[model samples]
Target: KINKGGQLSMKESGEKDKNECHGGDSRFMAMTLKRGRKKKALEYLLKKEESTVKAMVDLKKKYA
Candidate 1:
């Protein structure tokens, strides 16, 4: 298990922060759906979708 803010640098912490953001967004979507805020949830989903797509495109370009 990773230590809590041990010797990791800011870059490492930033990566963890991004992962938490993604996870939190996913949980928020589920909660929004449960509350019948489907539209808002979908909007939030699109932002994630956009970010994922951009990441994928960058990865492809990097390897291709």
Candidate 2:
């Protein structure tokens, strides 16, 4: 079954199996996904900053 987050969850046979659905696994998975996304964004920002600094240095050297 697809959950509201578009993640495929186990379609439990019991309607009262709410605990199984909202257990630690789903929470852990969400945290892991956030961590991966955060890491990627940080890497991208660092690379952009590095390129901007390099460009500034090159421009200063050209004008000097």
Instruction: Please give each candidate's TM-score.
Output: 0.40, 0.24
Please provide, for model 1 over 1-64, each residue's C-alpha lDDT reduced to its tens digit, 9 standing for 90 to 100: 2223221122343455443444444344445566767576556545554644354334334433
Candidate 1 matches the true fold with a TM-score of: 0.40
Please name the candidate that would achieve the greatest TM-score relative to the true structure.
1
lDDT values, one for every candidate? 0.43, 0.41
lDDT of 2 by residue, 1-64 (tens): 5444343444456352442356422343344345655454334334334543344334334433
- Deviation of model 1 at 57, angstroms: 20
Clashes of each: 0, 0
Which ranges in model 1 have alpha carbons more than 4 Å from their true place?
1-23, 50-64
Q: Candidate 2 — what's its lDDT?
A: 0.41
Superposition error at 51 for model 1 (Å): 8.3
